[model samples]
Target: MNKIIWLFPFVLSTLYVSAQKKTDRKTLSNLQMHVAYLASDKLEGRRTGTPGEQLAAAYIAGQMKDIGLTPMGEEGFLQTFTVKEGREPAADTKMSIGDQILTPGTQFIPLPFSAASSAKGEVIPNVNEPDNIWLVNVSEMDITNPHESMANQYLKEAKEAQQAGATAVVFYNSKETAAEVAEWLDQNPAPIPVPAVWVNDAVSKKLMADDAEGFKINLQVAFKPTKRTGTNVIGYIDNKAEKTIILGAHYDHLGYGEDHNGLGTATKEIYNGADDNASGTAALLEIARLLKASKLRGNNYAIVAFSGEELGLFGSKYFTEHSQIALSQANFMINMDMVGRLTAEKGLQIGGIGTSPAWNTILPAVAPKELKLSYDSAGVGPSDHTSFYRKNIPVLFFFTGTHSDYHKPTDDAGKLNYDGALSVVKLVYDIIDKANGMDKLTFSKTREPQMGTNARFSVTLGIMPDYTFDKGGVRIDGVTDGRPASKAGMAAGDVIVQMGSLPVTNLEAYMQALGTFKKGDQTDVKVKRGNAEKVFQVQF
Candidate 1:
């Protein structure tokens, strides 16, 4: 009896130590095997609903099975669905107004979903005014992103135009607006809205003159909406029925655009989303592998790789609302996005930290002391995780900050910082294993989202900023005019240097300072209007 009792303690200790080793920090390098394959050129850009995406899904499913993870859905590992492709304008279309043959890009741009319909109205005699005009009104359907999609500058502009009764937009290539728009396009080449057309300086001058005649516009513009299938590869650990833990990442990226620019060879411009997602997806697979290998189960854990995140968070949104799994059963969400760019200069950024008090206690302990971590409570931001937050699910999104490579064709597996990802994945596994072992976490009714400091305000700031901005911040995006910042003279091209009295050197600091004042509070703000810094303030 004495020997058995002694052995009992030793046996329990051995089991505990073995379980710990299953998810310890050193085992993350295992991601190398999975990430290399998933992010390889063989997967292409893994655009949602493409053969590449399906192949990735299959690989992930097979890995999950090999690691011994159970299938979560009825149809095996994939929680498959479809998304309506954005309206793509004809690439080689022609547009001309009166005497001017507008430049394809500079003078006129077609709406993505402008419909297969073409418009050729007599230049609304604006030509008699100095320029002939073709007023192409991009229909709301072709222009407006589905309400379920995350709102950005285009959506804000659409809302404003709708409110202003601005039926058509006239884009003129004067010295100013043309240059401004050119810079805008370099950063963002996504779909644009409008019954819009552009005019050259000479054309504008004619319109401005009294000799402009009855105008005529000939347009061969075309927009068509098609449906494409996207996949959400899922594998899970069946555990307690209580609250489930959702771990997700987006697996698609920019698809083929241009052809080979070298010699006589034809090379596809495939944007393999290695760091953009293959890294995160690989982490998910490795975590699933570890969990499966351990054969330890507790809270339900859903491991999913989402598609359509590049176009929008369509795959994630669809899965969150209409899932083979129950939403309420979800306790919280952890999203790993853009995690392959870890560096010593700029460490990790943890979002949604303030949403749940649990993170306050846990993340600090789980994060490594050697690295710097920035946390925020805005439980919502511009990512797939936002979809879950809107549904009231507390969420955490992990990012290693943005670089020039993000969304660019250069973002490939070759540029991924393997060691950096290894550190992050190890940290994540610690958190996941801890969350898996806990009884559902408690939540506070109100969360003060943090960017850098503890300044909490009751007001909401509306803007979808470019992810790469940090210090002397650049605003590549803006919200509707009636919103707080817009009403305060904040424009898209303006670089914000100071929000209030605080130096706005980084995103966290700016957010923290913004929290100091509430919706009704008015404050002074500084921005670079052009080459000069301008001071402006307004009542929120």
Candidate 2:
């Protein structure tokens, strides 16, 4: 009996040691494997609702299954959702104003946001009648002013035209306005509330100056809206505890270098968002493995690999709203995003710091010495964590900061700091370890980050500057329709080397130079396109 008792203690010790090994530092090889496949070109950027994303979802589900986690999704490990996909305009679209047939590219272009509709009516100046087509001139409107004001004006005018029962509205603008509108269409390529067309200055002049009896307009705008499918992978460990802890990571990224990509130069390159999210997804898998091997106390665990995050927070939003376990039973949530490029000196940026009081004390206490930390009290930012915060749940967001390759095709697996990511994951594990047996985390409201909800700039160049461009000049990725940059003949791939007399070396310089210009100001903007330096006149 004495010998048996001694052997019982030895057996217990062996089991404990084995468990410790499973929960210890995650293997670098495993991280590499997950990242390699997730960010591989074969996956084609894993865009939400695409076959690539479906493949990634299947892989995550397989990993969770291997980790011995119970499926919590509607279909085994999958929580599927539907989204509306917009179709491109048909090439055979036709439009005519009076006796003149307008060319699609040169004289006028149908806004991509227009729904499929055909209308023929008398062309009237402004919106006086509900049955007529309205024409509004925006040549005098200052393009350099804040977009909110200009956008507000467009909204106000469109609402009036709609209220007047106008079937369509034609905007008369300069070449700049045409370019600005083109850029806007690139970013918001979906059906708008009203049908609209943008016509050049010459067309506007002919409409206003010519005899009114024959002034009629006809247009055939085309678009098709279809349903798209998306999936979210949910895994769980039922500890039968009162509250559940959640861990999540977004796995979706931009595909084929669309409007979101900060194109260094215009070319069809796949945006492999390895660091943007593959790193976070890989970390999620590693953490799930560790948690499966660890013994929990008084709480269940749920891990979600979210899709449709690039389009918005569709996966997290759906899960929180339709979770099998009530959201009220959620103890807290932690999110990992862009954790691959962790710079030791810069450390990690932990958002939603003020969401829980315990975090203020607990985070500092358990933070590893090897990891540097920056805290943002805001619970609201541009990520999946915001969805949980809206539910009054305490949340923590881990980010490795932004870089030149962010949202660009160059963001590949080779650029990731693997050791740095390991440190970050370890820190997250320690935080969880401390909170294992604690009471449900208390929720607190945090001040929203400035960049969260507002555009702080005094003026805009009417162009979308590539936020990830590290080059000498501010690279124009998308020019807004009817904006000054468009008026200045600035196109995508054009680098603004000089704004007025100011030498623009980078994004900051460009913004600063733009601030110096006010509404109605005119200046020469210099751009580097190919090997040639071209200067164009811009009216702010």
Candidate 3:
């Protein structure tokens, strides 16, 4: 420990070190209090752009100010942005559909970012009649090899039928249908450029029956697209601007869906996102408190809590890209996503190990061998860190693997494994300390092949699967993001029911059709939802 100097601030580094023992417990307790409130149910999973999220931002900013960290942006401690999504008035409104009294709330919801309007449209290419192709959900896995999945086959069939000019694509719900459907609807609901609506068992049968004459649908929905604010809560201790270490976490999760595990309505249950991200946010605050007490004052470390991670890492992406200072100020970005739980009570998954050469070298020096640091050769995965990685920044994402509770209401704080989280945080803290003192540790990308399953594959398809399509054959609510579907002049409202000679019924079927072809494969993908039956070529 260094000695104190006369009349100098923080000159007594020795005083800070010995005092660490006396302050550890109290500091940790304070951190726990802040995290507890941030992760509470009142925040509604801290969904981006929601009222609950706004409340969370206020709470976090207050905590940051209390810690004396400078605001990193013009908007106080908040880095704000808007995320577009589909939503409709709760299925409780009343309206008129031809002679029948059309109900507003439950039958349809406004698509995310759909134009605000009062819509009245007739059922074109009516699928309720016999002979119209309909989409249905199925479950057929390659159990013989768990590593290999044929999930895309379902989507392939739907694309084929849409090309055939199928009148409608009715869909069947899956085991995770409720949550997935809500997500689908939130991203892409019906009735923008084209007309589409979701139907339950009774409504679907009623519309399909011939007796359902004078069948007209009327809807009044409102959509707003002005601007919104979000935040990434951060606190720092800067003692003369040194190299930095970032302890970061995303404080967002998938909000409540249409149904909660098929047991209760989405409104009744909350997707607490406890493990999904609440756990990560909690750790960030705790680490700040720890370092503050330890007087680890040389480095300019930031403990950040990010928002909008569920809706595609919006908040973290903003902070890293639009920093007040240079992005290179920090040596490493250590992120914790779902570190509250451990699989088999034996290991934690550490992706990005293969992404950086330095990770492979330094991991052994700081982390336990038995704890098992896992990795994907590709440093990039579907998380907030991907934004940084794409920018050629060295990054690490900590995950505890996925579970049944992922993206579901069951992801509650009551289920969090605190001991597991503590262990992981301790391990990460050590890693940062080791890296902080190193002289210019250079990081290189590791382009390793993926091992087991491929969630997405690059194939020629000019259709977008709209979760809000509410039809069969892997409902097409929108076109693939930045794919041939978008380039071939396809729009979000267009649903693809068929591809080439195959019908895309579900994600599984869609995968199977794509599997039959190699790269540079071109084919006619058919999208027929909401009276628009057209075929487009998807070139590989």
Candidate 4:
């Protein structure tokens, strides 16, 4: 009897494998076609807000349309969002003292916080006359505070000059002590109302040489914020159900390493990101197809191909915040990121298991016996699913482990494991099939990861620094419980401006500051929360 029972189960498993093989041929073909085009050189790595990204969006929308899925975006399967690239001085920006013209970038450059306005007035030193350009010599200014940025000191001087009735402030340093002032421009800075300019050492020497005779100054400090539009492709399958399940994948990658997020040393070559996300995106389309044609109709499906994910979850965050569909009716969210490199030995990684209690039971039951699975309970990860999880929705994230080619130009279409991607697609389909008639999953909070974790550092604040925040300092995206940041009362959205005696000007500066500290150290951390700056005592 036992032998007969085992043979019956073996025969059923064989039948299932045969049926899956028959269907996988077409699925694999679709995966190959989608990946080849999306990861092709023609798409230019599909960097968000670029022409390549637009082409990828259009292609994804066309695929959704061909699948007979309903458009769920604001504009017929296309949802647009503005992405702030950075700021740059305008082409017409110019500065002149008498007849001598100062080059915009070489001789003189507008401060990052300078107002984009023109100022014409007589230049005079040590004269704080109203409606006149004041030349401030910062060569002898006190800069003893190690925690204060030199740029901030210049800004303070400008603010003082403005308060003293100066129309515009021109800063020049004659001493070598302030030689570092040349690197003062912040890539992303908050603008001040008053116009400010910093002249190079050569220009300063020239100005000082002609200081005896006051000259009429013509200054124009104009800056334009670099921005571009990123589109998210959305498609839906309306099953006439009470709840909708969201499936998402990012289709954007680093284009020629322009974003500086690529791991490869070569920036000229395209970081195709086929395994990073093209695989996930292709898998999403296949999952959408399976769900659309499946008999399960207990819940609706919203499949989204997100852009600007490589730029810090911009697309997914925007979608969750400004969703056209009712978020209150959102049953759950599933995200696929870097799902193309799965191997039998490397296995599959499934995150957000603790997000919903149902995941513990449902995942194991639907997971294929041939596939090894690892689980991460945290709902807050470095992916799009975190956006939905933040909205109090249950979430699941699928990933095939990173390889040597991750975030490199070699992560191309040829490196993808199409069979592995197919297995993931089928696994997700089975999960959806099993949960078709179940009640809405319950959300449960899990431990957050200590983002910004570096092996060189011994201490961590236990906060996820927002990679998209360019304006100065490191912004906290999330705070882990029982960590230094959370214990110190730091919360998400707070920008860490100063750590101990070091100025946290940017993410790099923050990491460097962390290296200065050891475990079991206590220090005062300053953060800008909303319009106010607050200090917290952190114990690390």
TM-score of candidate 4 relative to the true fold: 0.70
Compared with the true structure, what per-residue lDDT tens digits does model 2 show for residues 180-286? 45444433544555677777777877766745544678987764334566799999988888999899999988877543434434457888899989999999998
lDDT of 3 by residue, 414-456 (tens): 6777767776767777777666566544566756324236544
TM for candidate 2 is 0.67
Candidate 4 per-residue C-alpha lDDT over 173-273 given as tens digits, one digit per residue, 9 for 90 to 100: 64322223433443556766778888888878766775456778899977766767799999999999999999999999998877656656553898788
| True-structure RMSD, every candidate | 10.9, 9.3, 14.1, 10.4
lDDT of each: 0.65, 0.78, 0.59, 0.84
- lDDT-better candidate, 2 vs 4: 4
Using TM-score as the measure, the top candidate is 4
- Candidate 1 residues 5-91, lDDT tens each? 999999999999997666554445566766777777787767777788888888888887887777875489877776763333356
Which regions of candidate 1 deviate over 4 angstroms? 1-30, 85-225, 257-268, 445-495, 498-540
Displacement of the residue 154 alpha carbon in candidate 2, Å: 8.0
Worst 10 residues of 4 by lDDT: 174-183
Ordered from best to worst TM-score, the candidate numbers read 4, 2, 3, 1
Single out the weakest 10-residue window by summed lDDT for candidate 2.
449-458
| Residue 313 CA displacement from its true place in model 2, Å | 2.6
Cα TM-score per model: 0.60, 0.67, 0.62, 0.70
